[model samples]
Target: MLDFAIFAVTFVIILVGAVLYLYPSSRRASGVPGLYPTDEKDGNLQDIVNKGSLHEFLVGLHQEFGSVASFWFGGRPVVSLGSVNHLQQHINPNHTTDSFETMLKSLLGYQSGMGGGANESVMRKKLYESAISNSLKNNFSTILQVVEELVGKWSSFPEAQHIPLCSHMLGLALKTVTQLGLGERFRDDAKVISFRKNHDAIWSEVGKGYMDGSLEKSSSRKAHYETALSEMESMLLSVAKERKAQRKQSVFVDALLQSSLTERQIMEDCMVFTLAGCVITANLCIWAVHFLSTSEEAQDNLYQELQDVLGSDPVSLDKIPHLRYCQQVLNETVRTAKLTPVAARLQEVEGKVDQHVIPKETLVIYALGVVLQDADTWSAPYRFDPARFEEDSARKSFCLLGFSGNQTCPELRFAYTVATVLVSTLVRRLKLHQLQGQVAEVRSELVSSPKEETWITVSRRS
Candidate 1:
């Protein structure tokens, strides 16, 4: 009740203030083609709400307005670049990881040390990126262990039993990310379950709440969301403290502990990785499994690649380069699912894209979904043909979008490694089959996921 009362009051205040501030006098800020506020106070926020998510809204927006478009975000003017040509003018993938970092922070309400000098922000980003990299490198065997355990469980299931693909993938991702990104405490199954409970509680509401302000309307939901956020933060606090006290630490933890960052900085970063890492890793695996299940040829090619490269041995770090077909399958899954549909960066200085001048501090969006499935770019763009990725042209398209190669953000790179290990193991042992009469439809939000409980049955290979 207290949570409700407080949020009710806060929501009312913001609502009233927004109405006055965004009164009918406000005008569209760009010459670029796009939407004006349907109601002056709400801008295109209502349109986004009506269309489901920003990604969906962009799909329609770009369709009507072409690749370069504008929309008001609340009262502020925002620009979206929806084509590869437009994005090439605006992106430095290396620097734009911060945009994703900011987006994650917004969705999770991770606002510790948010006010800092440029150098401090730079230092923290380097540390966070390094944390994921060092952890993956230093603890790869642990990743293998998690994959082996998951495969073992699947092997034990009765023949023809329908597996809850999303549910299991979420657990597998949670277990892998929590154990590797944090520590061995997650090796305890109970710890992983507890963490996942809180994670789901927060993620479920916040994914919509950040955009729609729905969480504040119900106090019960607010209370639960806040409670889970508190618990997750406390868990990270405990982990950080334990790392601090240890005289002997793994290279991963030691790098973080020795940093000049304040405790809150470390905690905020841990929150970013924990939440973003889990969702990305889980969804990537889910889509890859589902897509491969739907296409026997793709699965066969991936399985054959596994056999040829990793014949009679588990996937090794050195062997990843040789697993060309596996990489193609994953890349195609990313494009087909349009995983991570939208990303935005705040302009640091005034800039020009094509013919328009973007004012400093404007929110500039990368309309990744529009281009990922663009008909002009790919032949039969919606088709799930992994063979397309074999072409240097398709590969270049992926790189330009920052969805392939080293240009992808660190968390995605991390997810790719984890997915490769798990998928490689599963494909080697089981033939994944999609359930009959199930059409693929996605819920495109912060990331793309199956709109319903996606079920697949796997048969053990003789």
Candidate 2:
């Protein structure tokens, strides 16, 4: 889901490509009410930068123009839908693939047809689906083991010690994703640490690089990025080779092996799942724990749920789904954090929303952040209330916002499970509390990370 932000910063160029020549940026074209380009070439991109992020810009744009609004994204008139009704109309019934994955394809410059035809696409689709499905289902124990190990590590920390919440969560996510997706090689801490080091290097560069055009301006920074990327890809390639030779069909890599996807496609797919998966899982845990630390009532409720459903037993896959409140806590965290704030879809055919007529190929922004906080949809939209999810209407609203429902992305579903298991296990043994006067601001990057590391203290429960 980081694709929703990382590639989005560059989408105007990557997605539209040469379309700027076909349609002039000056023309508003449709009845959609919105802003026109302030500059001849850059469109409203400067205004977006001035407003902070695309998410923030959309917030103001929708406030001024209502649910459906248009803005210039680098010489292209892009329309954004900020209400549930608008999104319902935009939802494509037949396009079943994840919307963010399509953005990823644009980022990787991968053409679905270029690798193979319709039959091959179908096979690869099955492989992708089964890879995530069977990997999580078949390897649930492995995921639980990793979660237990992290709980074990935390249990060892001195009582009332300040824990680096962000760092520990990120490390845990990387380890879980690697071992489950590739193989047991990641069971060794050194390999996982190495991957983490290189990933940190690459992640910092890629997120900031595209945002400010620094990746291209600084040669050394770009070199380090490529080097880190190469190392990460090489590690995955080694796993792919080993899995292929063994003819293993157990996890994600093996599932991809069953398909005729080129080596490049396999690597890219692996990269997407691992990289995006890690950030999402890490941030989800960080925010969930942070939010819990600040709310004693919610913490008590969650702990009670764990006690009722799990008791003193270790977390098992069978019981994970039974932790209803646990899922709500995470859903509220995602809604509050706006982890993936914005996502866009290409208008394959001319579409209409209200009185607006969308031209073919026009980029339709989801403006998810705006809708996530819209007063009309949510009660006290800014409050961190997991209990809101207790209502069926609230759950339906979340699905309409594209965070859940039948269309939930595999990465998120995976993150939710891993996070629930880990958080459940920890809360069962220890009490979590916020540091006095300790507050952290949201970065709203790749996937809503804390602007700086957020620290918390833990003590054994009485």
Candidate 3:
């Protein structure tokens, strides 16, 4: 209740201030090609989402309207950039635009006053980069320890034990992030459990707001959301207080605490990091296992590469790049799995991409899932062939947009380190096999995940 009250007050003040300052500039219209189709007779756009064919729908739109097209969302023009050229033009590396902030604010209903400005965003990004960089280099000890713990658990499972990959991976990711990001070790702590509950509660409500204020429309949901946010905030606040008191720390939260951001702002970042870190890393690991388990050739090649690089020695950050096949396998997993299907940027100025004129304030989106599988760029697009990435030239293609491209998020970069360590450690000892009866299918969420419970059996390789 207190959190909601504080938020409500801030929301009102920011809303009024925005109306006075930003409304005039935000009223510009973009003249783009395609609009979200609406039924002429009923004056309602077709609810294509109900059919669970959003990916097919997006492909159809691109095919029909060309690379750059527009859709109407709540009377605002959202331009979808479908091709690599369009993506490069719109999400240029030189631009200082922060797409992640735009995404969090627009999609998550984050108020502008809560860590929204360019400078604040930069501070947060710098802090994240610094923490991850330091941890990646200096904290390999912690990472290996966590991975060994995970391996022990897997090894203890009985032979042919059907392990639910998603749940297990989630736990591993949670533990890893808690240790690396928070500068604290967590092993089923009550506070950790509370944090997970809140983290899930908040994510479950994504994309549900903004429909006539639907987040607050249901009192029960509003209460639940408020409680979750409050609990998460409280947990982080306590951590922050303790970390601040003891000035000796080297974690992401410590970096954040030293920054100019307030405690609430730091909490917001911790929450975002949890979402970004845990889900993406988990999906990457799960998908890597999924593809490798099914493809004997890829598994053999990856094992050979690991052996060639490590040679019975343990995996470390220093050796990740030398294991080229492992990188290829992971890259192929990202390309085939399409964990994050789209990335969006809000156009701050009128822009021209190819022949399309994108107006100011338009939400420019990159359709990664469609482009990654584009037949023009990828041969045998649907096949899980890690060998496709064997040639550096093939990997250079812009289709792998999320992590490898110019638009790579820091979270994904951090995920690579975590995923590399886990994959290297696990595959070195255990031979993974997919359960024969269950056919894995891709399901779309905020991130992509397997539709069914992905069960894999671990057998001793040596």
* 34 Cα displacement, candidate 1 (Å): 1.1
Q: Which residue pairs show backbone clashes in model 2?
A: none
Lowest summed lDDT window (length 10), candidate 3: 1-10
TM-score of the candidate numbered 3?
A: 0.87
lDDT of 2: 0.76
All predictions: root-mean-square deviation over Cα? 6.3, 3.3, 6.3
Across residues 287-351, which tens digit of lDDT does each residue of candidate 2 receive? Answer: 99899888888888989998898787877778987989999999999988777777666665777
lDDT of 1 by residue, 396-438 (tens): 8788777765557777888899999988999999988888998
Which runs of model 2 end up more than 4 angstroms from their true locations?
1-29, 93-97, 109-122, 207-212
| Pairs that clash in candidate 3 | none
- Lowest summed lDDT across 10 adjacent residues in model 1 is found at 1-10
Best by TM-score: 2
**lDDT per prediction?**
0.76, 0.76, 0.67
C-alpha positional error of residue 245 in candidate 2 after TM-score superposition, expressed in Å: 1.5
